[model samples]
Target: METIGLIAGNGRFPVLFARAARARGLRVVAVAHRGETEPDLEREADSVTWVRVGQVGRVIRALKAGGVSRAVMAGGVNKVRSMFSLRPDWRAMRLLGRAAGRGDDALLRAVSAELESEGIEIVPSTVFLQDIVVERGHLAGPPLSEREAADVRLGCRVLAALGPLDIGQCVVVERGVVLAIEAVEGTDRTIERGGSLGTGRAVVIKAAKTGQDMRFDVPAVGPRTIETMVRSGAGVLAVQAGATIMLEGERLIEMAARQGITVVGCDEHGNVGQS
Candidate 1:
């Protein structure tokens, strides 16, 4: 059986990927990051190796040893934790030094290069799980009301302004006014913060960076996102089509429908104003 390397991070995403890969008869060789990846991954993977957050060399060695020629990154290692936590191994230190002054893209690209140097190809996380990628159209619930659609447009404008800065992927808008922007705190916090400032009917927009690196840091939302919106009183979610992942999409949509939250997938060039 062919073995694929999984660089596991946090959340159910890695678990879902492992299950899908196994169902397809692929042997999963996973490197689960300590304090980041969930422990349940060991039950799903064929072979699991625990490694620290920045142990690049060990990851490469583990994959090579498992005869894995292809790999996929699943889940996210909290960027905030990387700021204070994480002790880098020698290989990670070298890669970080070489990637000085670069952002997330440069860092992941450098890591991808190191893996490729070891003859392991990094594949898109959607490889066997394309169904979870949100499709274009209104998903779950009814279409946005005219007023909510107006907010969607305004939120899109806000996201466009923030995208190039790599500040955040989500924004909250109400009545044509921007209420909150996501920063280092991440999506859920951003929604909660933004929703708190809105009139209990804010529209949330999440999209990829203008020139986002697909290999890592793709914008993602799931069941928890809807729960956050519900908690924050946000009424609608408008994510960019073809650029975001909706985890447990069907269940997420059903929950959103039950909550009466409108979910729309907008095109890259489409303006929220056009709605």
Candidate 2:
């Protein structure tokens, strides 16, 4: 079987990736972050090594020792918690010292470069699970109302403007008003904050960065996102089609339908695509 390395982080993405890889007859050797990665990952990947955030040296060694020549990064590391608990080894420190910026893309690209230098090629996270990458369409729930569509368009423009700066992938807009832009606090918190200030008509837009590196840091939404939206009073979700992952998509759509939340896939210009 072909062996692939998994650089696992928080959430269900890592486990889902591992499961997909193994199902395709690939051997998955995973390097999971302690406290960040889901415990369930251990049952999906063939083998797993736990490491702290910023332990690039350990990650390299683990993958190398496992005969991993190709790898993919899955899920995300909590930026806020990582700030307080980072344990950078020499390799990570070196990368950090030479980094031009502290943005997510810069840090992730540095890690990818380091791994590539060690002959471990980093592949796109979706290589094994392309089916869940949502295409442009009205995925679930009611069609977007005129006001909601306007909010989505506004959110998309705002997100595109912010993307080049390597900022967050999510923004919340309501009735043409920009409510919240995701920062280190992450998408769920951003949603909660924005939704709280809205009139139950918030539109959540998640998109990839301008010139986003597909090998890592792909935008994702899942069941938790829907649940959060339900609590936050966000009624619509517009994700960049062909550039986002929808984890447990069927379940997510079902939940959205039940909650009367609209889910649509769109382009950078917020033009909803045909299914």
Candidate 3:
């Protein structure tokens, strides 16, 4: 079987990707983060090497030993925990030194470059499962109210404007007011905060940066997102169509329907089509 390398992080994404790769007859050799990656992944991946947060050298060594010339990064490492947990090797330190900025895109790009330099190409995270990606449409729940549609449009515009800063991919808006812009706290927390401040009709928008590197850090939403919105009283979830991935999409839509939360896939111009 053909072998592929997986740089696995936290959540189901890694396990899902590994399962998909294996279903296609690929041997998955995974480098899993010590605390961040789920232990269940060991059952999916053919082989797994556990490593510390910033152990780039070890990751490279493991992949090379597994004969992996191409790899995909799946899931996410908690940025806050990573600050304290990172144990950078010399290679990681060197890449950090050369990185232009501390933003997600900047740091990931630097890491991808380093991996490519070692003859290991970093492939797009969605390579194995393209169908999960959102397209421009009304995915679930009731058709958007005019007010909700306006909020979605406003949120998209705001996220696009903020993209260049590489601050975050998510924003919360209601009635033309911007409630929250995601920072280090991440999407769920951002939703919680924004939902708390809204009139129970907040719209959540998630999108890629203007020139985002799709090889990693792709924007994703799942069932947990709907659950978060339910708790926060947020009424709508709008993601950038063609740029966002929806994990467990069927379950996600079902959850949204049960909660009466509108889930939409929107374009840059704020156009959202019907299902």
Candidate 4:
């Protein structure tokens, strides 16, 4: 009965959100990026509007046309692409002027503020998928060794160190040796970069920023993540409990198990468990 706005980006996350939201009897009004979003989302969304990247005002206008006043940002845009490929409109240019310096979070916050100024509220993307959060504990495969755990702690510290800069949310490490820190290239590439440097035992840790704004850009991992980890020889995937999204929850964990990779959820304090 309610109408929700969805600002969709690339990959399966937006499609999943559309299906889940519609099932709850909410009208899904989606503004999707033309090249980044999956074309199949038209089947899942009640209404879909396509825009190129950086057309913030256009997105808001489309949502308003659909009678939506609340929205969620699902999936992701390639930040590198956004940096180099955007064609900002007048409003987006203004937004970029105000939000240009602080990295991803600042731009998202500015976008949210702009939407609010136009009477649209940005909701948490998990509004309909709360149960899929990576809970604290060992989710699949063997338990992590003390050495792996140390790497996890180190990863957490590194994320905390980097988060305030609005950098990426994941890192690949082994025995405290850092392999890759996720920048605009994204999580999978970061894992691949780190994994290739090691001898089949790198650990990938993904977490929220130290001062993360949960309304947008929550870290997510999916089947492709496991596939990448498998290819890169990363043996463990650790995510921050209750913050990271385990996309396609069961299948992702199952894939990790089949590949003999550990997928555990850890707390901010580094305690590990499954529940």
- The candidate that achieves the highest lDDT relative to the unseen native structure: 2
Shift in Å, residue 273, candidate 4: 4.8
For model 4, residues 202-227, the per-residue Cα lDDT tens digits are: 99999988777778857888999999
RMSD of each: 2.0, 1.1, 1.4, 1.4
Total clashing pairs in model 1: 1
Model with the higher lDDT, candidate 1 or 4: 4
Candidate 2, overall lDDT? Answer: 0.92
Itemize residue pairs with steric clashes in candidate 3.
none
Q: Which ten residues in a row have the lowest lDDT in candidate 1?
A: 266-275
lDDT of 3 by residue, 148-237 (tens): 888888887887788898877899999899999998899999999999999888999999888888888688999999999999989999
User: Largest TM-score belongs to which candidate?
Assistant: 2
Q: Which scores greater on TM-score, model 1 or model 3?
A: 3
User: Cα lDDT of all candidates, in order?
Assistant: 0.85, 0.92, 0.91, 0.89
lDDT per residue for candidate 2 within 1-275, as digits (tens), equals: 89999999899999999999999999999999998999999899999999999999999999999999999999899998998889799999999998889988889999999999999999999998889887998899999998888899999899889889988799999988999999889999999999888987689999998988988858999999999998988889999999999999989999999999999999988999562
What's the distance in Å from true for residue 102, model 1? 4.2
The TM-score between candidate 2 and the true structure equals 0.98
TM-score of each: 0.94, 0.98, 0.97, 0.97
Regions of model 3 farther than 4 Å from truth: none
Tens-digit lDDT track of model 1 for 1-275: 88888999898889988999999999999999999899999999999999989999999999899899999998878888876886889988898989844566678888988899889999988888877776777787777788877777777777778777666788888888888888778888999998988877888899888787776756788999999999999988998888888888888899999999988888764343335
Q: Given candidate 2, what's the lDDT at residue 227?
A: 95
